[model samples]
Target: MNNADSASQSVQTMYAERFATDLTDNRAEQKELTAQIERLRDRLEQLRTDETWLTGMQAALPGETAPPRPRRAPRTGRKPAETDAPAGTAVPGPRPAGRAKARPSRARTSVKKAVPTAAAPLHQLIRALMPLGEPRLVREVHADLAKAHPERGTSVQVVRNTLETLVKRGVVGKGIQKGTAMYTATAPAASEGDEAPAAG
Candidate 1:
C-alpha cells in the first residue's frame, strides 16, 4: 500500500508540471497575437490617412477627371517563332516596297462669322447695371440689361463670364450665394460718355 501511494503522488506532480507549462505557453502566444493586432491597426490608420490626402490633391488639380490609363501596345514588333515561321523551312519575306512621298496636307481656313457688337458693348452694359456697394446676381443683371436696352441680346452665361472677367480686372467685387457668383461694382462702373437724347 505504501509503494502504491508513492506512485500516485509522483504521477500527480508530473501532471501539475505539464499543466503549468501549457498555461505559460498559451499566455506567451496570446501576448504575441495582441502585439501583432496593434501593429496591423497602426498600418491601417496610415493607409487611410494617405488615401484622404491623395483624394484632396486629386480634386485640387485643374483637370478634375482622372487621367486616362495608357493601353499596353501589342507585341507586333517581335512576333513569336510559332507565328513568325511555319513548320516548313523558313521562307524569307518579300522586300518591303518603297514608301510613298507624304503629300503636304492643305490647311483649311474656316470663315468666322462676324459677331454683331452692340452700340455699347455688353461689358459696359453689365457694369452699368452694378451700382457701387450693391451686389447683384447674373440673372438680375441680365434682366436689367434687357429692360435698359431692348435691342441688345445678352444671356445669363455671357453676363456671368463678363462679371468674372471684371472681377479679375479689379473692376468688380465677387461673392458666392447658393453656389452661384454675385458681383458688385468696386469703382465707377461705366463712363457716361454716350450723351442721352435731350428730353422734349
Candidate 2:
C-alpha cells in the first residue's frame, strides 16, 4: 500500500510539470504574434504617410501628367497705373510746404500730349456719327470715310481698329454675325433740355 501511494504522488508531480511547460510555450507564441501585429501596423502607417506625401508632390508640377492644383480666384484689386516717363526718369518726391509746385518737365508733358494725338482722330470720327442705329461692317465704314474725306485715306484695318476702340470706350455696341463682328453706334444719355415733357 505505501509503494502504491508514492507511485501515485510521483505521477501527479509529473503531470503538473508538463502543464507548466505547455503554459510557457503558449505565452511565448502569444508574445511573438503580438510583436508581428505591431510591426505590420507600423509598416502600414509608414506606407500611408509616404503615399500622402507623394500625392502632394505630384499636384505641384505643371501639365496634364500631374494632378491638378486647387484653383485660386483672380485678384480683383486695382493695378498700378503705368507712367509714360522713360525708364531712368526719377519720380519727384513730395515737396515741402511753400515750395513752388514742380511743373511737369517738357519731356513728360510732350509724352502726355502724344498719347492724346494717337487717340484724337479716332474719337472725333466716332463722336461725329453718334446715335447711328444701323450696324456697319468695318469695310463699309472705311469706304464711307474715304469717300467723305479723300485726304484722310484711312485704311479698312485702321477703321476696324478705331471701331474696336469705340467699343472698348462704351460709345459703340459690337455684335458677331457668322463669326464676323459688326458695330453699331450707342446713343448718348439725353440731357434735361432734350427730355420730352411729361403727359398729364
Question: How much does each candidate deviate from the true structure in C-alpha RMSD?
Answer: 27.8, 35.0
Per-candidate clashes come to 0, 0
The number of the candidate with the highest lDDT is 1
Model 1, global lDDT: 0.55
- How close to the true structure is residue 5 of candidate 1, measured as C-alpha lDDT? 98
lDDT by residue for model 1 (1-200), tens: 99999999999999999999999999988985675566556656644443443443343344443221111112222223323333344231111101101211211111011123234566776777778989898778877876775445455566778777777767788999889778888878554324222210
Tell me which residue pairs clash in candidate 1.
none
lDDT of 2 by residue, 1-200 (tens): 99999999999999999999999999988985675566556656644443443333343233322212121111211111211221233331111111212322553465465445333454455445444677878767765665544434355666777777667766678999998888887755232123222210
How many clashes (backbone atoms < 3 Å, residues ≥3 apart in a chain or on different chains) does model 1 have? 0
Q: Weakest 10 consecutive residues, lDDT, candidate 2?
A: 71-80
Tell me the deviation in Å of residue 123 in model 1. Answer: 0.9
